[model samples]
Target chain A: MAKTVDAKHIISITVENKPGVLARISGLFSSRGFNIDSLAVGETEEPTLSRMTIVVKGDEATLEQIRKQLGKIIDVVKVQDFSGLDFVERDLALLKVNAPAAKRGEILQIVEVFRGKIVDVGQRHLMIELSGPEAKIEAMIALMQPYGIKEVARTGRIAMVRGVK
Target chain B: MSKKSKTSKPVERGREPKTGSQILVDALIAEGAQVIFGIPGGALIDVFDALYDAPLRFILTRHEQGAAHAADGYARATGRVGVCMATSGPGATNLVTGIATANFDSVPIVAITGQVPTNLIGNDAFQEADITGICRPITKHSFLVKDVKELARVIKEAFYIASTGRPGPVLVDLPRDVSRAVCEGNPSSEISLRGYKPVYEGNIKQIRLAAKVINDASRPVIYAGGGVIISGASEQLRALAKKAHIPATTTLMALGAFPEDHPLSLGMLGMHGTAYANHAVMESDLIIAIGARFDDRITGKVDAFAPHAKILHIDIDPASISKNIRVDVPVVGDAKNILENLIPLVEPAEHKEWLKTIAKWKKDRPLTYSDTGLKPQYIVEQICEATKGEAIIATEVGQNQMWAAQFFTFTRPRSIITSGGLGTMGYGFPACIGAQVGCPDKIVFDIAGDGSIQMNIQELATAVNNQLPVNVAILNNGYLGMVRQWQELFFKKRYSHTTLTGSPDFSKVAQAYGAEGRLIEKKEDVRPALEEAVASPRTFVLDFHIDPEENVFPMVPAGEALDKMIDGLA
Candidate 1:
């Protein structure tokens, strides 16, 4: 069987801030076998509404299906697929990596180049915060891997479409 | 707040104080709800109290499942949102199957379940269940009403959401405290939800393109489904088919959308579909799917289904268009609107060669069975003849359902109700009661298999008590007929637990329920038994001892193409 090539898609949905709405949305994705690469949700400007940014990997047809299915949910206010749009995408990562006094200088140099900040410091580790596009975050993590990374916590990608168009 | 003012005007527009339950009743009545089928429970006592003097008529069903299926039947019969209600916990849980059944078949029904008090909701109070959460997947939408002010709006929204676009079941969980609370204000009648706008008009470009495809195809077939009935597009579908001179096939849900007796009608197409219909679909150069999702049963072996055809799918739900089978053109809108738009652009063309080929196939392999002792097919055929094909026939899932779909010639929309998507057993009897209730003057019959009927047979009392003249024709083969058929073919006749040798006599059961009952074992008794049931002023059950070894023919084993149907008892 010939398979359609899968592509990464960033979909944002605004929904009513009610219990079980998240379960309904996420359940639909999981039920249809659509893999969620990353998901981030928070309250929108309207206190009664919540916005969810979901990154999924699927073919164009499958993504279109997901978008339409999402639109069908009563609580979902709007679903926008930013896969084909020029958007500002960002991911925030908190890395607690092992950094001795000698290695701390090397890690600091890499963090400085990536525009990261040291949020906390321990006797044997430094917790660095990095905020950027997924690619930049990936690069920063890769460079910090040699410093004997101990722990990593990352917020999934969130996106906003560029200016009025 | 004066006592004199309250006493003088009990229900003054905005001055009188009404309980939350009163507002709920008023909201339902305002939404054009004629009747509700449900059972009362502890959590729903206040709602029932409010309903006691309300304008609505409530049919207290024996079981919550019966209430739900009855409501589903009402919705399918009338094309209106059917309403069913029950209290929390077991009462609410019993409605789950019926809700799923309605959901699977896209029947518009609003199920209102009573919950524990607002503060006690998460604590799992007596008779409490997280019904909204439990019903999330099965409902089009669900609401947990905590505040009295939101009750009216939520009810209105539930009706709106259930009846729009691709219709399905919606649930509203009303907490006991909310229903009992007193609200001084009038419930709002208006609904403004930003997220729920359904597109009803097809794209002009796509409509035109579809018309062109229809006009140019050499072997075009119009495959219609339940959406045609939901959108009331049967007339438009017939017009398009007639104008384009195209043969049409309907799914199980779309049985009556196209006249089965028409020259262009291919009775049904799929697993239990007619041989000619399946063959026509297989050989067609173009398939214009109007409102029909290419369900797995309809499109046997998706990759090989209509392999030679260029598909055009028109439906109200955009999600259903290319969800199953790939299509060359997709039209997302109401079926009626799209069909109306496409009919004008369609050019009249005669497919003489194509029609000739289909006619030959029809003549070569007609749906037939040998005249044997009390055959189920014979009973279904007799019923069709006796009713003149006008009776509202609901069937339990299995051989009986297949036989009804195959043997009965349906001529009008909403005439045949069966669980198509869910293939649920125990759906027919309660649904029969609902259909009879909705269409009081129409003759209703539940063509049931012995095994399937027993699943919800207790509803016989509900039918009898309501004085509904519902005729239940049980095809008793002493086994779960369809599963047994599969066992015979695939499981080397092991039979397993398919046999129901100890099953009670359905006729006796009907008699026990204070309804008319008859047992027939001979072929000659079929017509008279049916005639007797039809003429009876009360509910009747006619149990026919059909041949145990019989099977639904023209079987296309799962995962095989339509053309590869294994015909006959081989």
Candidate 2:
């Protein structure tokens, strides 16, 4: 009767802005065999503190274990699990697609429908930047996959609680 | 001009400018550091120079590894944040194993390593290694101080982090330039870190709930670990166990947390644990785990471990709760404080039937080994008798460790120190040196195997020079006893590379270092040798030639259930 499949979990951690703090956090995760699906880190309102939003794939017990382990890190100030809460998640991705003269018009049309922007243009390709939920980014990437995608770079998911205080 | 002179004079009077090295020394002293273990090298000359005038005493170890282990031992024995220092490159790298040992065992140790100059750090200068990076995984926290102004603060923070919240080793890498740089500030005695806070009080609700469970259960057992000693909760734990009339078992790291002579004591539980303790755990309805992590060695076949029990885990580190084995009630706090709160709430209860069952199991398969020749267990039992369960015993890993843990009856906290989690060989001798230094009035013994004794044999010189009357009892079996036993049982007696046939005569080696040495080959000489070593005022080494084929019993093979322990030799 044990659960066989892992569920997705989003955990946010606030930590001090010290060198190698990120490495310490990631090292703990890897050593404990917790798979980090998506990770995004940035400075919070306080310049000395950084917030890390990590999406991990694990069972409920695994997530709880991860939360406890994360809290044990001395540099980590707080750990909050937002997977079961109302949270707004976003991911930013840039795609370099093979946009020949023929496909340029079609790519632009698709970009318009997806609310994307053309950030850079090259001789053989056009770079498109998109920011939205992980699903929307994945949809955009899937649509551009047929157009011979040249390259892709993504700033993994970041999340915050969505509510009016 | 008079006003300017007055302002400058006030500034000079208020705070004296000192070099970073001097400030570091002052900071350590302010943090109440009494002794440090280390060896000086080129990069740390300035710091050593400053230490020359400092009030703290430094034990010059033969190697940096010895220094690190000694510091770990000092911390384990005294409950103080032990300090160690080493120079850059090889000196720093040599501390890696010892740091990992301390980290795994949760010993509070602050390891300070010298680094190359800040400008020359990445330039691959002579005797430079990225120690901060190297020790990051092994240490609780690490610092590479780029600015001399932060030297004192970093040292203070290192001590704080090392000693608090499941204490472990912390490394502070001081660059040569930073150590030599002049800084204009006095060391701060106050520490206020926003991120680092350890929970010391257990939730009353959880404690009450745990008490209710303990009261309701027909069969209950208490499992204690090293945290009981670290938090100084031995008395509280004993009081709780005695009040509840529940049998208690301690892990290897917690050997002395509960007195073995106590009637309620089930001794140690787990792989090499007592048969009765393991059986009690397997059959218990309520398991109270205090400051103990359910490590793999303790909980074999996690799914089958204590299947009928509702575990109540109490520990200071929240991470250790339900990390390996899931628990029903988790209390995160200092063991002493939590037990103090819990003992009052837990009503007196009796499990006469449960105790009877455990007692029957204990009487049925007691810890025993067949005596064909001079057995290591026999020697350990004799040592225990000689010390009257008072000497602090430190042990290296392998068969000797298991035998000591099994045979030696520990009656006080911090009396038995071993590398439990890391299982590092060569840990005992140097650690005994630290233990002797930490507790100058107590007799300290290092129960070592021949193979393990040779790992840090050079420390005999340090022990002799320091005049630390550390008695080392080498269980000489002419083979790496534990590995050979494993090979014999699991590898069809392959015996590949396990023989240490031509090992140096330990007695002669001890004499060469200006210490007393005795080689006891006969069984009758065991007590006399031990007595002589104990009575001697100087360092001594007794090589007890034990049975070569003897093996530690009551071992639960890896991945097997605790109750499925293989009892004694066929």
| TM-score per model over all chains | 0.97, 0.97
Clashing pairs in 2: none
lDDT of 1 by residue, B437-550 (tens): 999999999999999999999899899888999999999999998999899988999999998988887888999999999999999989998999999999999999989899
Per-prediction TM-score, chain B alone: 0.97, 0.98
Model 2, A119-155: lDDT tens per residue? 9999879999999998899999999999999899999
lDDT of each: 0.91, 0.92
Candidate 1: where is the Cα deviation over 4 Å?
A: B1-14
What CAPRI-style quality would you assign to candidate 1? medium
DockQ of candidate 2 against the true complex: 0.61
lDDT of each residue in B98-136, candidate 2, tens digit only: 999999989999999999999998899999998988887
Worst 10 residues of 1 chain B by lDDT: B4-13
